[model samples]
Target: MQAEAGNRSGLTLSVPMDLRQLRYFVAVAEELHFGRAAKRLSITQPPLSFNIRQLEASLGMELLRRTTREVALTEAGKVIYREALKLLALARDAEEQARRAANGEAGAVHIGFVGSSFLTRLASDIRGFAAARPEVEVVLYELSSYEQIDALQRGQIDIGIVHPRVMPSGIASRVMHREAFACLLPETHTLARQEAIDLQQLRHDDFVLFPRDFSPGYYDKILSLCLEAGFTPHIRHKVRNMLTIATLVSHEFGVSLVPASLGKVRLPNLVCRPIAHAANPSDLRGIWRQDEAQPAVLALLECLAASPA
Candidate 1:
């Protein structure tokens, strides 16, 4: 719509030409016959002819030459016709991009996850979502449950796959996975042959546990469970990552309790046995901000909901 003066006809920035007019001109120019163009546009010839006349007046030039038996494009008409096609194509692309963005088919989503989530069905869910929405950019980060909560509140991540905790105000959550805590032991340990081991039976064994600072709430929950069983666990080693804790237990460093889902994996030198009469642990889940529900994030949440817990 910017101004370019005195080059061609009376066409100027102030003339206020519209897409409909450009479409009409292109149709007439391509067909080189007003009757055919009017039929194609699903309009009567009189109105089509009038619109063309108005277009030519605005441009201050004769765009089409009409004889009793034929019609043809003038030199000025040829130039404008080529540029009009490009403009119309760009306009269509602009509309399509806007629509795709609104529908959540194109954009980026940031997800933060705890390491333990990968051992469960969460990995498959992430893969499925990425495959289904190729246009959506998926960004991932590994963080602790506490770290994820901080990231969500500070607007650093859109969603968090984390351990259960007390959600702060303005946060939303859904339990995407749940599993009872199982006793992790060395494959060669005496308890490995048993279907289940009593929690009190391990009172003399050292424990590999997460540090209280990793998640004070979860740490306290584990302690409360052990205390209920009539004993205080002697923590021999503390680790931050769940996978490392499993590895440590596999190497015969100490005994530990873990999610039952981890028992699905047949790790070398490791055996997961249920703790008889043990209380259920808090569930692993997905969390996000309630006030800022972006479409891309919602689409990912749907994928998580459909995944096996």
Candidate 2:
């Protein structure tokens, strides 16, 4: 058996009045005169009267008691007038929200980034974006390249600033060449005095490097650079973050290779020197799901483009 709408929903609902009719009704109810309401609505009195009568007929009630001299709302009309005002306000709010979303001036963008990205201009660029776009919220998450990939594939984040490589197929990306490679060492290390050192020079040193599982391509790139220098490194520790590696190096745990940008960071006891053989590599790549190229994401990308890598 067919069920009544109110019974099915477990809540009584009034007639589904359209916004135009409700707007006309509210204007007349507030002004209490057909001539003033028509002027406010930029229409003539005849159509306004017709819509008010139609609304009354649909609801099966006398909304207004009128004569040639003045118009006044009946008791039932006063109640619906308040409710109609509320409904009209909600409709206007919905339209404004929709327009803002389409223009990319509202909504939120969730971003996932590796820790090392903060060492470059990209960090300041992001801060600039937040400042300029006050309406679009920016949600940030610190994650490894692996975690960023998982989040991207699962639709957990809107953008991922990754390292070493871009995400897999079906994802979009922008390569941002952020930094050149550098060797990290304790300030007292024998080779620390030189501003530039060849990769082969540190083949014998124990290495503190980012873990392979955290970023496989980056891990392999370091290894291949070592092989090109003609020796395998003696890895002393595998860590997840650049700061941790710097902390370990400061304690004289081992010599390490990191981005030259890291030298700009305040690691009290650590030092950085350019790797002679380490050519420029894009330290960060912005990745996101192709399907999720939303306005907020695009706005962020536009801001990212202005900052120097």
Q: Which ten residues in a row have the lowest lDDT in candidate 1?
A: 1-10
lDDT of each: 0.84, 0.82
Clashes (backbone N, CA, C under 3 Å), per candidate, total 0, 0
- What TM-score, computed on C-alpha atoms, does each candidate reach? 0.87, 0.84
lDDT of 1 by residue, 85-126 (tens): 877887799888778777777788999998878888888888
Question: Model 1, which residues run further than 4 Å from truth?
Answer: 1-17, 264-267
User: What range of 10 consecutive residues in model 2 has the weakest lDDT sum?
Assistant: 1-10
Model 2 error, position 70 (Å): 1.3
Model 1 TM-score? 0.87
- Scored by lDDT, model 2 comes in at 0.82
Query: Which pairs of residues have clashing backbones in candidate 2?
Result: none
Q: Could you tell me the lDDT of residue 52 within candidate 1?
A: 88
Candidate 1 backbone collisions, by pair? none
Please state the error at residue 42 of candidate 1 in Å: 2.8
